[model samples]
Target chain A: MHEALRFQPVDAEPVDRADVVAKSRHLRRVTEGAARGLSLTIRGLRKAFGDNEVLRGIDLHIPAGQFVAIVGRSGCGKSTLLRLIAGLDAPTAGGIAFGEQPRAQDVRVMFQEPRLLPWARVLSNVEVGLGRERSSADAQARAERALVEVGLGDKRGEWPSVLSGGQKQRVALARALVSQPRVLAFDEPLGALDALTRISMQQLLERVWRDQGFTAILVTHDVAEAVALADRVLVIEDGRIAEDVTIDLPRPRRRGSAELAALEGEILKHLLEGSEDTSGL
Target chain B: MSLIDSLPRVGAPKLPKVDGLIPWIVPLAIVLVWQLACVTGFVPSRVLPAPTDVALAGWKLLLSGELVRNIWVSFWRASIGFVIGGGIGFAFGLANGLSQLSAKLTDTTLQMVRNIPHLALIPLVILWFGIDESAKLFLVALGVFFPIYLNTLHGIRTVDPQLIEMGRIYGMTDGELFRRVIFPGALPSIFVGLRFALGIMWLTLIVAETIAASSGLGYMAMQAREFMLIDVVVLSILIYALLGKLADSASRALERLTLSWHPAFQKK
Candidate 1:
């Protein structure tokens, strides 16, 4: 009966933050030493919408399999940077080249809205990620497997409209992961979900990223969420990477730990300080 | 602290179920009243026949096979006209929906013509094709065309732009995009057009057959009126109602089958 309540922990006990942090640091160090997932290198990427320049020249490098979160005030070009990387839009000036040349099927983006086709069932929506290359039978099999991975196996036949907000996002995640894309770009996909649902989604995302080893770039406005899920949190100001703060904490880290709170504070400090200069603009 | 919890809970009002015999009661009562009036001579039988008389006339026509033959003839004409008009409408809609160049070239002209009632074109059509089947076919087809064309165009235009962007990002080809996204999105509206076109089909057929027809339900009613056979005329009217109801039910069934994904169509 206790296990039926998804929000509650299976074993109710107070965890020692210091001990968990030490263990996670050790685990992360061991994993970091090994060959990681796909790496992305961006050199002076610029995007301008006519006279309004969204992203000025920017440069960054992300190690493969590493989860990086970009946080900024609205209209800071974080989303634009993501769109450029996803190949949804072209870069106006500087070039963005992957470590390995990625195909059209190699990158997927999950928008704030689930963007599920209303006419399609949840399983068929996932099958869309497979594109036109696979047979209907193969696509169906893969889609079912993906749905199971997202804990939506029973809901495969349901229309997307019937699903909850969190469920819709889960189906979107399944759709993105079905193709086994090397890079997954999230454009504040959990912004519309309730607080509890958002936390669960963040955990789900962390677990999926760990299992799949896909390079993930999350563009979010939540500073705590960025500190919680990302290996490194990037603070963007005026379309530029103002601060790159590495989170040395390990997996399954305590949410409200002093160490995590301190890191969040540090990132917030930099963000506030950066915003002061560009606030009027 | 808990405002919602503090509020009184009011149960929803229970609606009376009219799914059984309740709906039939009113029509049956109306028929009873009519039959009583006819029997009592409250209404002249010459102007409006008794319900029993109309039923007997229908049975006679059915046994003689005249009713069946005329219904078949009208059905064929309607089917042919619908196919021709609906087919052209669908093609034009697709062309205008997909290509801005085509829309710009033809939409204005089409809209202008659409404003002119097809019924008003009857004199011109009669002059061109005479009082033959061609005149009736042309009228029925013209009447069916506008609704289908307009709704199809509106459906294509109003499809969510965000879904199209998602499709493009996912590397869907133009044909695949149309099949997976645009077409499904537009289908509900297309069905709306089809239902409307069907109603127009019947209306046009009735008018055309009445104006100039040698054989059909319309012609049979006209022949009955000439002989003052009010019962036959009443039977013909009933037959038209039956046909219209059947056509509507068939279209609704198709809608249910195709648009099962739509929330509005889902069973409670």
Candidate 2:
């Protein structure tokens, strides 16, 4: 346990522009870009818990490599939809399919909280989803590789208690990425971080997604986050998709850029107006 | 008086030091009044000896080694009984907590039997076991079982449902789920049961030995009372208190070591 503190000291540098582009290239080489154009098709995905109807026929198709953001009020079944797709929870009716595969293993979900096991070292928590059957040495290698990708390569042996909020989330991100799934689903993974940390994570995620060319769906309540990160923003209203607005902004879009701000306003107006369609945007 | 002075004393207050002696004042006053009454021929000394006489008798018993032997016997019996009862209680508690059929079938009987004091079965147990170590062990086991069983059951049932669901979602096998989620989550409560059972085991052993026993602290106390050796009885009682305190301190240390991960115990 005393040796566990060896990885405690770490420095987090912001992702450089050239590094982002190069990392994306590296990811494509590794996965052979098999994740491109992988779309999610949801058909009449209905669900009810006893007398309470949480989800009412959520239907949408996410085109491959498209970054889609789902936004909604607290009880709009937004999380339930993510859970259904991640195979964490069963749907009452209807179905969700990614390509031909239906099981949740193909899609990885990053939860809001880091949820790292207190007893496990930083690298060990990242390796947990890799299945526990592997020898310790093999698991350590895989975990170290994942941690390196997240820029925390040196902190592999440290206990998670010593990590900052941003670093812990980075570890969580590494855990999600270790599986190398085709589709990535994030349930407000950065929602709990501070303002500065949240922005940094948002940029990090955008870089990773671009590099890997994976189909990603984010569930967030922040309109700015939705507009900044998504190829298209879908508003979940009363258990249904109220609006699906495509964002025409180019890559490496700034948060307060004129184009992105205009798109944020449009999404926000639609959300607050309780509009059923994106006619204004 | 010398031993009492050896104990650390807090700083004196501005007011008279009388308050420092306040706790002992009442007991001391009562003793002084009783001794005075006895000397004045108001009450017979046979019924209640002076505190000093009791102390002198107690010192003699300690020097004779009779007190230590009795205490050792009682301690051994209690410790052995606790290990046996605690082990069985924990096993049954886990089974009943985890299984619906087992819990339903046994819960009613356990609840009923737990309410009946272990001492109440003393006559029956002695008749069946002939006042041997078996009867004493049985009494201690009976006293220990209820707390250990109930606490273990509570611990198992109280595990966070969300954690269990998380295990299932993560594709953990049933064995993995129990080991990772259920066991750790229930550990704190299980320890609670174990400690309570241990403490009760000692108490019950003393009670059992007092009623009928060839050699034990409780038997020594009863024999001292018959022979008017009040000092021996007092010495035995003090030893019992010391034994209980020792067990409690050890359990507390174990608790702290095992639950080191809890936030409340963060290392400075």
Candidate 3:
């Protein structure tokens, strides 16, 4: 229909809720109630460590069930932004409003490090994600289901010490997923993984995002990753959003496809320009 | 990717079960040489009793019920003092480690007190508790307290902050955090403290019992010394060695049990 083409914006900033509202409508018609996400609206969000202001003011609106990637040079406050969104750290100024004040289990974070408890078995580690319902008797069943989702059900009884780097991160993903969170914030979750594992993990992440419909915000340094997985990619420069690019391409995006490569190149070019300007070179 | 690659690999070479007895050879040899030296008159029994003479003394004391009674008394005192000291030390460690305010209030005083050698307080302890069982108990308790306190505090403080943050993110209460993460993480260090405290516990008890009047392995040794019962004295020394080794083995067993999750404690 002409309506579908006319209503949806490709990508632009400042990213407005109108884009999200329209996109979600179009998405609901396409996927039909698949998303179980909470919309996040951040306004004038600022964070400072002592006098060094990291995030001057970040304004963002993530639509329910959208995948948003934040890419930046180191020290550009991408991780800090994820922390603020996840409620792990308070913003110095401005405010962030989730559509609802999410329940404790409704917001989960997967850190770059697996952070799985070495003392706890894989299944118990997943159960930890259940919060207050950890003792609810059916908690084990739910945790097992989550592990199976991550292809780690057979590893439930194994100690975390024995798991490989990729396996450990998978267990961490299971832990994050077990709670069925509405908004999942990832702080460079795949940064430590090898290239092959990173690709597969990306596929797994995409699959889960599609299946669960959680609003996922991934903070990373990889431009290709940003373009590959994100519906909208926000390039952070100088503590603010430099670009808000929407990848309108279809699902199961080919890794080496020209369209994906072009988007990746465009973002990388922008990042380099900003860096060059910063260094006055 | 093939099924053969996934098949189980052969493990390390198996040791014959008799390999367990390898360590016993030296002890047996030393005892044989000791008994032979006494038998050949190369060592005088009056000065250093033969192994058989010491065993005979042990048998006689066992018959008189004196040996069992003394050992039981020493064992009881050690257990009571260990429980009291270890309990208090563990309580203080938990408080100071978990709370900034508690550490601020007590840690400095504790550090200052820790520098004073606990055994040096014997004269003052005698003046205070008067050579009764209480005095010896106080010495043993004081001696046992510091190691547990230091180790427990260190253990709690050194639990991975990342895991603690993860626990908080997952919605663990303070009690749940301590129970599931902090305490278990701290246990290996606490075991280190336990082993150290056991050594000091025996050391303090020996000094206290020897210096005081009645009823323990040390007291028995002292009485035998007065009567020139060299064999009895030798038996006492051997008992102390046996007791120290026993305590160390017991703690190692406990550590193996509780810390099976640790990489170092995991069976090869």
Q: List the residue pairs that clash in candidate 1.
A: A37-A64, A38-A64
| DockQ measured for candidate 2 | 0.21
| Arranged by lDDT, best first | 3, 1, 2
User: Across residues A1-281, which tens digit of lDDT does each residue of candidate 1 receive?
Assistant: 11122222212434444334424543553455334356899998889999988888889999888899999888889999999988889999898877788777778899999999999999889988886545566788788767766667778999988888999999999999888788899999999999989988887787667656789899998888998999998888888888888988876777999998999888777777734664522
Task: Report the C-alpha displacement of residue B230, candidate 2, in angstroms.
Answer: 2.9
**Ranked by DockQ, top first:** 1, 3, 2
Give model 3's docking category: medium
Give per-model TM-scores. 0.88, 0.79, 0.90
The worst-scoring run of ten residues by lDDT in candidate 2 chain B lies at B259-268
Tens digits of lDDT, candidate 3, A34-82: 4479999999999999999999999999999999999988889999999
> Can you write out model 3's per-residue Cα lDDT over B63-170, one digit (the tens) per residue?
999999999999999989998888899999999999999999999999999999999999999999888999988888888999999999999999999999999998
Model 3 off-target regions past 4 Å? A1-33, A274-281, B1-13
TM-score of 3: 0.90
Please list the C-alpha lDDT of all candidates, in the order they appear: 0.85, 0.77, 0.88
State which candidate, 2 or 3, has the greater lDDT: 3
